[model samples]
Target chain A: MSGSRLSRRTFQRLAAGTALAAPFVRGAHAAGKISIGFWDHWVPGANKATTDLCNEWAAKEKVEVQIDYITSQGNKNRLTIAAEAQARAGHDIMAMPSWEPHDKAKLMEPLDDLMEPLIKANGAVNPTVEYLGKADGHWLVVPATAGSQIKGPCSRIDLLKEHAGVDIQALYPAGSPPKADAWTMDAYLKAAQACHKAGFPFGVGVGGTPDSVDTAGAIFSAFGAVLVDAKGNITVKSDTVRQALDYYKQLMAVLPPDVPAWDDASNNKWLISGKGAAIMNPPSAWAVAKRDAPKIAEQLWTHGAPIGPKGRFAPFVPYFWGVWNFGRNKSAAKSLLLHLSQASAAEKMVAASGGYDLPAFEKLTLFKTWVEEGPPKGTLYHYPNPYNHQVLSMAGAPAPPKIAVQIYTQAIMTKMAVRHFQGEAMEKTLAWAASELEGFMRT
Target chain B: MADIAVSRAGTVNGAGGRTSLHRLMQRKSTVAFLMALPLITVIVLLVVYPAIYSLHLATLNKSMERFVGFGNFTFLFGRETFWLVVKQSCIFAITAVVFKALIGFVVAHFVHNIPSKGQRKWRGMLLVPWVIPPAMSTLAWLWLFDPSYSAFNWILALFGIDPVPWTGDAYWARFSVILVNIWIGAPFFMIMYLAALKSVPEQLYEAAAIDGATWWQRIWYVTLPMMRNIIAITTLFSLIVTFANFDIVRVLTAGGPLDHTHVFATWAFRVGIEGGDIPLGASVSLFMVPILAVAAWFILRDITKRGNEA
Candidate 1:
């Protein structure tokens, strides 16, 4: 075809597609509602429930909300896509995970005025929400419902007391629940080894998957080891990592022999079925426990992870909220965040998700039941200090996913550990891990 | 000279008249182009443009901020895990391809030997692994690899031994992933080979048999050569797929216990997608092209040679 003919045809089609889209765009605009886009998995009822409830709430209000919802392939993918859009003119009110909020903050509007009124009206709003959401003293996001710190050692209490001949109460005579936090790294290893020696499988995440990283992070924070400090600096080259690695080596022996190969969710199935004796996990594991192994579920408890002799640390994940500065409906998004931030809304959402939502604020809502009952959280361990150190200190405040830590630790730094177990070079693994971490940290 | 000039002018006029006729046909051909207009638009818009866009992405550095000519490739070279991944890709592709071909052939032979009536049932049963969704079926493998509840370990334990971390330990993890690939892919090869096998004339087998040709000789000369094209095509297709596999590895170990289990696809995902380093990820995925291209080149060469021989 001649260039002129092709160019004329391209112009004609562009005109047609635009003409068709124009009416709907105008119609949505006339309604005084912002066209917000988001994935369904980020909120309670996996964001769909929240959107539906928000729509219902919108009907009662003076203004309407035109929700543009997209189902995410997964949470990480959802956030990355949202972050891209947030950078562009794509979304207005994005209900997103706060996992990488700082990275995506380029596209978010500050919400200081919006937040102050809500927080003042409703007490027990997490102050940290303001700290994280603020940039230059203005809010980019308000507090959304988050994963609470009410986690515990979803250990095989029956197995531990009976087989290991260990007394749970005697171990931590101080904390409300026999605190796993107070237990020394040495003690934790010994208990796992004892459990293993007596024919019980131990659950510690050495595998470099998400679950393994969390497992390691929970323990590492307890040891006062930070992967990257709160300021987004690489800080994994100190005695903190050294001590954690040394502990990890001793503990690997007692871990379920298959723990190295264990995928993120592997231990939950094993633990509830009585395959693993003690999982350093959260109460989320209880939901499965309640259904599949009700007897085990009842015995499962949330405790602070063992405090390292060096420090009291917990790996807390605050599923903080950040409103898309680019989202269509600023008023509606803020309204939704405000409603969700309410003690009542947060409580209801948490219950609906089978206790997956932990109240961000301790003062406002009652969370004892949610902590004790959940799917993945219940079978795992939660350290109390995850709130103090991980959330309060922001142990996960680094800009990247904890995968960096896993790669640095297991892939390079711990190559020997992997090789030795596989009957390869044990000594070389240590040397390699140092060099790998050095290289990984360089970028 | 005057007569020659006059005749040449006449010839030029005649040729110009025909050129005008062909131009008229070209005008008619515009309608055919119009008919295919939407298809062409969609392909250019969605497929070709994206492929180009990804190529553009592949050349840039991690932030997508700066253009670095093959900087990603150079950076990938510096990565220790990248080399491991290169090794694993070759091992996985070559191993999975061989196993699929061998297993597929044996099954095809067995199915061919069966009465034609029973072949349908045998084929259906053999297709179970391939038919089941990799994710859904792998859930069971995921179960069998359970540390304590491992069915494989249970079986191994019955033989008076300890459980093996089928998805753990570098070698074991690599082995488990390949075994699963073989399970999922063998049936596809089998069906293709079966078609190739059936296409081979019955007369040749009878001819070989009447002469008292050994079964081995008959297979080596007739069946292998006859199926060579199909086999090459199937293996190449499987090689491309196995080399770029993300799901099986993602679902199984997610490149874990350590980075020990990482393949090129997962490692690329780690550096690029998950790590939020698009430039780095682009580099990793781009490295796969040459490897795939080489394999494709070999297969195409083999197919061409077979075509020439035939």
Candidate 2:
């Protein structure tokens, strides 16, 4: 009987076989497959987090899952979405960036059923997320936990202290209440001028890229400038819009002379190269600085945006996970999305992204990676809008999704400022914007 | 006579008479059509269908559900950006093509003058810009034109010159986009001109030289006359490609600085793909056909006429 007992090597073999068979055993319950197209993460280790989450969900759901991390570089993701919609085929699940959900709302499966339970469990999503993710009465997408970046001021603490004599830490301390009420647009202009004169201007872009558009949107939102309202009416020829344009024109004067041609990476490069004292971007730039330029990293602080006439508003670009209505495995796709949206999984994703990912849910913002990991120990603490000092918004918000999407993607606000800066009469610029909006509305 | 009789008997027995199908199979035109069937199918499927579909799309409303009947075109005519785009596309294509031709011609002459042995090396090196992908090369240009940390600015500072706003100001952005296009495209022209220059008979040049023709006169009379077909054909081809160019403008300026640098293709992309108005975008792109067709007709007609004369 003792001799017949299993040997140690045999027991080890048995354990290995069981481990390999676990997924197949689960597959016996539901035999199916699903493919997902995810946006390639800019931060290192973020993709692995998503892959692991998806694999785990697949095993538990007994479905084979294939994930493709597609890059957003050069608008390839948008092209893929467009092509899939046109052909009525592609991955069952896809990651849609800000404005994309609204752009492809017709082709997306309504996610209201999946999102309602999530809202109850995790609290309501940010209003900006709702503005872009929901169209009519249906939730067009599930707000994703990856690549949701907030464009806030990542200023050089040392330079701002030296040149502008403003201690950003005192104004928006990492662990303390924000005393940043005095940080108004007027102060921002002054700081920009001072920085430029001191030979380190702010690296704010006005180009057609999303980075530039988002910043311009925040500034416009702060001024309560609604180029197009929710009813699809052209509101460009207004006093608030004029004020926003005038302010942007003046602000552009003090920034880099070539700000108008900058793409999304320009400001990142500008900051990493130590040429700009501040840039409105996500922590990705700071993360790069930490690796490539440690000295600059230590002096960097991510804080709230400056206040405007309306209020303080920061540019927020959120990611959404939407399933195509033409997808074959709609049930499996929704299940995977729900699995990834769990609070535990969201935290892991945020941590893996080095605090780059911001969960749409309020509860997941308390991930430890935001506080514990940094050169300044808490540099990204306020990155998630913890202090409530700034209203997070995206480009062309507060308008009808159809019209706002056009205004945002076409970069009407940035162009308005550029036209004004180049000596176009305010009235002419307003008329031009009004006519463009009118065209959009008609379309 | 006996062989003809035997062939006639074989043809009759083949289909119990000479059937129309058997007769057509032996025809030259039928054989040629059969040979061209694959190519014709590809052309229809890939090119003709897409173009017809695009035109059809242009007549639809935004949601692509209703027939609008030239509404998009009329709407575009009313917009200021559309006019700017049309003007900019023309200037961008014309200026870029003209410069590419001139630069290519000069460089080809220079290469021709070189010892034949070393010409290969120079040609190889000069063709490097054309060989590299436009998107990748544009990245290098973007870095060089960075406003804050531009290598050009560093070089300028070293000399006592202010940094040029390579892509910042509206005019400068136009110049920068045109410059990058020329840099990338001139090499293609150079290669074509080089091939054309090689084909020009050396005897004509020697005769012009013997007849007391100066360098400039010889080129004007001999080289120009000989390479006229190649030059016109290349120019037309380059014009079409340049007019429809999207990658360079999309990468460099993205039609920015108040839409001062937008060309038709980029604008169409912005309006169609990004703006979510596919019908409007299709209409904007359809505007390119008329201009390209005119250019192609004139140049190609000349080539056919000259070919018939030869």
Chain A TM-score per model, please list them: 0.73, 0.92
Cα lDDT for residue B1, candidate 2: 32
**Each prediction's Cα lDDT score?**
0.64, 0.89
- Candidate 1, residue A284: CA error in Å? 1.8
Summed backbone clashes in each candidate are 45, 0
Interface RMSD of each: 3.6, 1.4
**Tens-digit per-residue lDDT, B106-202, candidate 2:** 9999998999999999999999999999999998998887656679889999998999887778898899999999999999899999999999988
lDDT of 1 by residue, A1-443 (tens): 57556587799999999999975663423546655544443333545555656666666554566666555343453555534652576555655544445445666777776667766765544444544555666666666554443333556667778766755545543223343343666666777888888887777656665555556655655666655554555565667666666677777867766667665476777777776788755555666678778887766654545657555444444555556665666666677667657766765666565655565554543344444443334322233322333333232334243334335324332333444455544345445654554444423
The weakest ten consecutive residues by lDDT in model 1 chain A span: A378-387
Candidate 1 off by > 4 Å: A1-31, A34-57, A66-91, A114-140, A146-152, A161-182, A226-237, A362-431, A438-443, B1-46, B206-212
Cα miss at A138, model 2 (Å)?
Answer: 2.5
